[model samples]
Target: MSKGFSKEFLWGGAIAANQSEGAWDEDGKGMSVADVIKFHSKIYVKDYKKQMEITSQQIEEAIKDKSEKKYPKRRGIDFYHKYKEDLALFAEMGFKTLRVSIAWSRIFPTGEEEKPNEKGLEFYEELFTEMKRLKIEPIVTLSHYEMPLELSVKYNGWEDRKIINLFVKYSKTCFKRYKNLVKYWLTFNEIDSIERHPFITAGIIPEQCKNIKQSIYQAFHHQFIASALVTQECHKIIPESQVGCMLTKLTTYPNTCNPEDVEKTLIKNLLNYFPADVQVFGEYPVIIQNMLEKENIIIKKESGDEDILKNNTVDFVSFSYYMSLTESANENSEKTAGNTIFGVKNPYLPSTEWGWQIDPKGLKISLLELYDRYKKPLIIVENGMGAVDKVETDGKIHDDYRKEYFKKHFEQMKEAIEMGVELFGYTSWAPIDIISAGTSQMSKRYGFIYVDQDDYGNGTLKRIKKDSFYWYKKVIESNGEDLE
Candidate 1:
């Protein structure tokens, strides 16, 4: 009934290297910020205040604790060793693209290194070549919630202006090395999340800072300059390539029709949109600037920072949409949490096993709002439900709920295109199950292909295709024409 997806629309899945690759210290790989993060119970997921305050003492203790059981991210699903088989499975699923992040510590070892580790570069080279051979285009994220642990411990993350150059060095090496194999690049994963989880997002240990707010904003400034600088270098190295900024598209709905509630919702949405607005429009929105001033936060900027941001804006905008948040003006309102965001509960919507509210229409709203705001090509880089999957006696998984979730979201995506949104691609959160980002558990699965692993890091590490795997294969094979 409507004009369908474009001929070259990218359809695939995405996984961060630190979340999927196990060999945390193999082949010259150094410890990343992700490696030292411990696996907390479900109760800690919503205690953002405590999580954000990661101290140096905690880091020292985590480094000494030689238990993979406590630190599941230290040993990811071993994608460092099993990428070939995984890519083969993705290719069999008719994936047109695969979104992956290059571990910064793998290449730089430490943020101060002048030369990259040749072994680290060699590994990604082999990985990308195989993807190219299978005709699978690679969309790479330069920094995806993982930076050198040494950076945070020694330099206090991106707060120091010198981190700009360090990040640029890492970016230049990647741009020059993998220019042939990858064309699409994202500067940062969820650049807006630094305030929520400073350690994971920007390698900042909040407990070390006297004024965390000031440090956070200063880091944001450095990252903005770094993103712009890398974007400029990416163009110089790969003339035909495209670069984008990724954000957590936090959609908010007013709890009621009251004008005050609507105003509160507007302000809440701006908090999440601030970073993306800078990357896409090349300047901070006036409201955000005013908010910073009110908070007494002064961001130290270099001489040409304005010029760099203005001259080199992103080519497209990518985002991860998992849930919609409800907002109310009432101070004492019922609240809930979802994948790095908090909001009031919407009674009409259901939640996943992990408490992330499911709102398929929210994806449509995000696409429409983003298109209207930026007028640039949009890509949904991550969107999937995490659930505790059970295998029947026959060794086959029947995950109809997961299938329904994607089907509804895919329908909304198609409707968005019909309404004149210029979408470039859609890569689901993960093609294969990896360690959970929040809880660091392998049991919280969100993949068409399941990895045989558990919370205690025990299993054969075998790959089994769920029923949704076959269903998604047909969807990709038909170019989103078939849903059932």
Candidate 2:
């Protein structure tokens, strides 16, 4: 049998409202950047068609680069309307907690509203109430890259200092409304990735903001301030609640055992953790400040920004560990394709159909490293494999591969906990398959319960249990003992 977890171990599923909830325009909700992008196939196919217009031979080259998401996935999996049913399913899976985001636009309607939207506020009130009815705790993210589109157009997104205050107002509103329902709060989802890929994540192109460095620095600064302010607000409003930060943990591996390669890998790994360290630890890493100065990018520290971070330090460090990468200064090294800008292939690990490296051990290492550096409880907010599935004649999906994927990761996670890592919990990327973030397609399924939807967006929105569903249920029921 697997090693049993602590008595307080939390098991649950995670999803963002924008990623799962379709009613983008319903209940006075405002539009987000996710509303514009099409699915992965449409993007790749269109690119392919364009390349072929230049030369027929370019088809091969275009196809190589065309991964997925030709268009934004259909207004998500309709979770806005189906959250009741979805939550029921999660309850069936024995979810002790459900990690979801409150759509920022839903509350503010416009990013800079002095008054909050009552309808948006009421919707989440009902949502959290339902979770409480089901005895499932809610782990809520204040901002999950769903910045109001109006904010982007008017003030260039987070570039202006005004956003810091606006974000705090929005966060405070939620805290007061749902203080009893949600004990776990996160300032932002994957803020580091948003800082890294502002255009894709938030539609704020760096070129439009004076310069690339200025745009990124400004975005990071605004988010850090927002986080700090939100943490402070949460304490005053919900003093007993635990607040933390979410990062997309893209772990790095050395290209080789050589000393130079190992040194480079160490530096690359530090880059991933540096963003969280600055926010959670309240001081920017020496290496990060050195690099910023070398690049001549001065980060303007607002009055009290340092105090905000220091006094409002996060209670935990939560991260999404998807896969690991290997980096080299060598220009000709093979490039790995995935969601993040820093993503690269690890020569030692196998890759998914989408070219994402699969290394369960990397998850263990990432957990240990974060705990070692931060000395705070670590919550794995997201981790899973996205792959293609085939439905057999019996109308069942025998996804043994996904089960194996979770098995290996759980084994390593158990080891990490044994190593003295204060792990809070582990939640799969999505309990139910929704839209793929990078490609914006539903075909790249990652859910235990598969929704019968396709690339063209046809089907009954039916939820079918994959083989992994039963496997995961047992894993939860036994609290990891079934894994062994």
Candidate 3:
């Protein structure tokens, strides 16, 4: 008997290998695009584009530079070797599920490998086994931001279409290896983010493409095919498994009642839903196709590509909702930072230190809107606040702000659930702070468990529980009824 959720409600946290696992090149792992994305200091906070884009020359330089200090993701709090200890802490918190992504390069090293990396397969097997031992369900994402750098360099990543077969190969290997261990699979982490950061997400460097938008859409088409193919394989390999599509849900509103602002906001939201529509409905939305045609961006699909997508729709829709955006037609309107895009400031809302607006009510709105449209079981796979935390002299990290963030969002989630949204689960963006995906800084902490590491990659790699850790543990024990 829970307050609002079903008895089997999933409550836990999420992390990606590229952000948490060090050992970047260990156990026959090759470089990923994430390895080449250099970490800039706080000066580049507003210039996130500079952090995500990597040129061929820069990749060559990164290959020559062996220092992990320059690229912080290369040494991500050492989760690669310390997952046992970390999982124990999660188990202590009564985590029902933990969402993690499998690094593609770790399994294939290069995308062209004839045989899968045995060591990488063994690592995840042991990981899933440990989670089972701890009574924690695993929700695994096949591809996060980390794609094999070799594929990016040789085939320009997904744009060449050959990478589709390669990704399918990698995915099949994972499915067969972990068939009995993992039951929940997400095809891609934030699949919609390809347009915002193409180089990192899809491995498409702008310099290599004659038409950037065309290449972006072309690469995305390939991913849609790959995702469908993998979903088909996942179903065949594991009958009880549930596969989903991940989106970075940037819910937007008009700044005013002006038709211009409302119309632009409507267009922006429609474009945002195009990726999920293909995954859920098994076909490209008409609006997205028309928009592509008007932009002169052609997606060259294979003969049965449509059939593959149409036949293999996702069983669930999972998304990350960190904040909301407000659109305005006036160019001089106040603007603020967000996950990957900027939007006009909402005077009614407050923002994080990174200028991402905090809007718990928007989460409810997003849930209602997505459910009404897709009519699918929805899971919020990622949601959490990134703030500057302090470790008191007593060695305790008091993160009441983090607790309050989750508290408000949980209240709204309960409201949405009670309002007839088929909401299922929630996995916080991270239970432990790893590396900032945008700026590659560790200072932007989002974890209930804090790592001793700093932005420059210094510290003992120790984990300390924050005040929110106990708060969240209670929330889970009481099943959404004990926020107090």
- For residues 1-484, could you state the per-residue lDDT of candidate 1 as single tens digits? 4486888999999999989998888888888899888876563334845754578898999878866778889889999999999999999999999999999999999878879999999999999999999999999999998999999888889888888899999999999999899999999999999988888998888777889889989999889999999999999999999999999998999999999999999998998899999999999899999999999998988788899999999999999999997899897887777877677889989998777899999999999999999999999999999988998899999999999999999999999999999998999988899998887878889999999998888899999999999999999989999998
What's model 3's lDDT at 419? 90
**lDDT (CA) per prediction:** 0.91, 0.79, 0.92
Descending-TM-score candidate ranking = 3, 1, 2
How does each model score on TM-score? 0.98, 0.92, 0.98
Winner of 2 and 3 under lDDT:
3
Q: Write the per-residue lDDT of candidate 3 for residues 186-264, one digit (tens) a residue.
A: 9988988989899889999889999988999998999999999999999999999999999999999999999999999
Question: How does candidate 2 fare on TM-score?
Answer: 0.92
Off by over 4 Å in 3: 1-3, 43-46
Candidate 1 wrong stretches, greater than 4 Å = 44-48
Q: Summarize candidate 2's per-residue lDDT along 139-249 as a digit string, tens digits.
A: 999888677867766766777778888888888899999988899999888888755557444446444576766777777877887888888889889879999988888
lDDT of 2 at 209: 70
